[model samples]
Target: MLRTVNVTRYIQPLREGGSLPALAEADDDFKYVLKFRGNGHGPKVLIAELIGGEIARELGLRVPELVFAHLDEAFGRTEGDEEVQDLLKGSQGLNIALHFLSGAITFDPVVTQIDAETASKVVWLDSFISNIDRTVKNTNMLMFNKELWLIDHGSSLSFHHAWMHLEERAKSPFPFVKEHVLLAQASLLKETNEAFKKLLTPEKLQAIVALIPDSWLEWPDTDESPEALREAYSQFLITRLNHSDIFTNQAQDAREALI
Candidate 1:
């Protein structure tokens, strides 16, 4: 289970992407990159972040700590920027935040050469989740303490957005692995693919999917209940895991073309 923290301060907004994630300090005196629920995709982005980040952690990959952040209504009144105020007001309930890595640097493929084992594992994990953000343009990874840590999974598990023919989408191979920044280094795809299959069992995947807050799963546009939505996410992941070969082969073929 994830810990919940109350945001004590609204530090500054990070303007890199459309979501406008911000740096804030919590009651625990730890700084975090807060992903607001009121932003672009709303709670769906938070759901993806929670699910994707936890799955990466379960695979023994480096990922910053994830926590449930509560934003109070008072924050909206003090902000001078009308846009920011609206964002805060809209996000008054619950949000998600990643523990800030104080001196982490953006990952540069040229500067940081990952070993085949790690690279293959990362490739397989992203392929499993269908995360499209780990490209050359936006690696969504950081180099902290000489370790590769993944972040910003708001674009992951994208099948939830369309919410149609989900089983088909789950069984589909992620062709975008060709564009992954680590494709060149992912030489152990076959070995790691088999290893990861054992790591991400159906029970484990369902447990990670269960981490998503009920509030986030209550889709505003959908008539489906929160429990149903959670079950859908769990089943989708399990089905994808059962058919991991489709994506693993696609990634291997892509890597072969690169080398």
Candidate 2:
């Protein structure tokens, strides 16, 4: 079960890349990336990441193992709003420290491209759930244990409301053919669809939806119950799964490539 933890010590920061307040563990017991809320330009960004990361895990995605943590006040101070701080404390500091994938490295989008089959699977998953984070520049995927591990889902779902408008709603916001790596490999969609169907059950989907904070939902006047939200999200998934040709094609392509 996912739970909160008390981080005892401060870890070294990873200087090369990453936009948030992230650090690498010093002790070798478990290499972890500690994401924190600091007094900076984007404190709310980290909070979004925590929620999205947990949601991805619940969806059966190959995300890193995550643990919600509390930073020692002595480490540093966060310049976030009181509401944000309260929300974090209410949700255990809104910090998600993920177990780092050691011996794994991020690849250039062109250098280590996923086969059309895998791309189809990934794109299908993202689209059904309204994930807009996995773009051409910021795929947020990793190669670990001879397989793909997805990371950094902070930019997905509720956080993407700003991009959602009348024009955007008319067409699929996620056009895999133009943006994803395996656009030409459309056949993988079938395999991905099957895998998604097997993993995303009504019960699991409900549980995950229930876990979402009421504060995250955009509709101010919409006082929908958690169960209602679950049902709605589930319907959304079913509708997209049935109608999305990209999902079907990509899953098939991915399955064939693996064979």
RMSD of each: 0.8, 6.4
Q: Candidate 1 residues 55-135, lDDT tens each?
A: 999999999999999998887588888888889998987899999999999999988899999999999999999999899
For model 1, the stretches where C-alpha displacement exceeds 4 angstroms are none
83-112: candidate 2 lDDT, tens digit per residue: 334333333343566888878877456677
TM-score of each: 0.98, 0.63
| Most lDDT-accurate candidate | 1
C-alpha positional error of residue 253 in candidate 1 after TM-score superposition, expressed in Å: 0.8
Pairs with backbone N, CA or C atoms under 3 Å apart (clashes), candidate 1:
none
Q: What C-alpha lDDT do the candidate models reach, one value each?
A: 0.92, 0.54
RMSD of 2: 6.4
Q: Ten consecutive residues with minimal summed lDDT in candidate 2?
A: 162-171
> Which stretches of model 2 miss by more than 4 angstroms?
13-19, 24-29, 37-61, 77-92, 113-116, 158-173, 213-259
